[model samples]
Target: MNYTLHQLQVFVKVVQTQSITKAAEELFLTQPGVSIQLKNFQDQFDIPLTEVIGRQLYVTDFGKEIAELANEILDKVQAIDYRTAAFKGILSGRLKISSASTGKYVMPYFLSDFLKEHPGVDLTIDVTNKSKVIQSLENNEVDFGLVSVLPDRLKVDEELLVVNKLYLVGNKDHMPKTAKETKEIFNQVPMIYREQGSATRLIMESFFERTKIKVKKKMELTSNEAVKQAVIAGLGYSIMPLIGIRNEIYNGELQIVPVAGFPIMSDWRLIWLKNKKLSPLAVNYLEYVRTHKADIINKSFSWIDLAQKAHKH
Candidate 1:
């Protein structure tokens, strides 16, 4: 073979640990054996893959390039192993995922149950806005992303998970006194906005345009928690995911306001690379969501309704 899989493994280990001795300990090999394997790979390539910085090993630029490719190759090899195990009736492995902010409201609820049923699978989650989550998906930093915004030129495979309504929220105490009064004050109160490129902001803006309404924004913030806190603190009012603010509404911290002519809807999407292979763990986790999404949504709506009723009481 080119340098043998063991040589590549040794080289990757050294690059990852940045210490030949650590790599040797991790790989259950002697330090000399690890050094020899690395040297063999370097000899095959006719250039040093790594260099010594003081006593620490540093990966050369060429080594970094190979390390990147090596990660992909290793991922593919693990995928093959997962596929074989799946064929023989096993579901296991790690599944890294990313999601937009609003997805945080619903994804955790579903993911918790999914994890309960599939204890063998490890899960990692990164919560961010639409743009960064998509970027992470594109960079292969995550296996898939749950997003509310769909880009024009999506370079990934996507499936609609569930669609949820966006809502206009304000502190009940600041809810314009009455509906007509609210309309007049709506333009007066500062409209709090999420950071730019937020799916919620995009949807809200699109809704305003279609309804021919101009909302005056008082300020902008980067987090749902911050936006909700500002609204509750009576600093300004804003739009947010209905599901996300259910608890706040129930606790009388926020109010859901209805716009006369505006429709607020967002589709939550599950996205992955177009030609990438999914490990069994990812496939099963996704399948679990697909099968139970309706029930999940229903349960969520029920909770919100209950919260609303309690608030009214």
Candidate 2:
């Protein structure tokens, strides 16, 4: 019947991580500290909140329900704290962004500086598929949407950050040996595909159709990392954003094969409804991204241009 907010926070984190040690790491507490708090909190309840079986922790159904309520409580507590900071004349409020899954590779770089400049700002970023990202925009659920391919249905203002180029990549063994071989490479190498609604998958499909290249679908995955790992493991070749797979290419685990017509280009843009009322926090974030976009690209994404050039020939 009696519990502290810290106890609730620790319990919710334990429920999320399913391990006292993992929860301790995230909370920056010692393992024994987390375990003691979890134990003390659980002792207040008659029914078991968590159970240990075969040395693995599992949250009971009631524990999950309680953790959800605890998370909501924490969020409200944060909102109150931010409001108090605003009262003290500090810039503080929520800045929410919904981004397409692949945009994950770029969005963080764009946000890092703004977040550092506004310590009081609360950020909620949803990284999902293009459809859900657009749907979130349409539903007015977020202040901005980060997308590589613009949605035709949305009438939005955009901050164009950087050029997004999708390249055909495979392990070294599957690469084309000559310019002529580039046109015929798909005949031998199987293709790994992103899930149906991803912009990458859509662009790759359109390219294949337009070029009349027969593709053998090796498998379909729901995200960029999954497809990239599949390609790295020699499962199949994939059309991936060079931004996401740059490290693998540098490490020689993947190679960009120059197709006769390749590197499908698009722009990653931060979009907001043309006339949506802007929150102060959102406005500041907008200014921050618009002003620092070039610097962020030059510093964090300087490799993109070089990579493109290497495979352009």
Which numbered prediction scores highest in TM-score against the true structure?
Answer: 2
Candidate 2 lDDT over residue span 1-313, tens digit each: 8899999999999998999999999999999999999999999989899999999999999888889899999989988998899899998988899989989999999888778887888789998888888899899989999998888878999999999988888888656555353668788778999887788888888898998889888999999999988888888888999889988988899988767677788888999999999988888788888788889999999899998777655
RMSD of each: 6.5, 3.5
Angstrom error of the Cα, residue 168, model 1: value is: 1.5
What lDDT does each candidate get? 0.78, 0.88
List ranges where model 1 is wrong by over 4 Å: 1-89, 181-185, 304-313
lDDT for each residue of candidate 1 in 1-313, tens digit (9 for 90 to 100): 3877788788889998999999999999999999999888888775667999789788899889988887778778777876776677767677888888878876787788877876556678888898888788778888889888777676788877666766677888877755552345466667989898788888878877766777788898998889989999998888777778876876788887655542366678888988888865677777887898888878765665454455334
- The lDDT of model 1 is 0.78
What's the true lDDT of residue 155 in model 2?
91
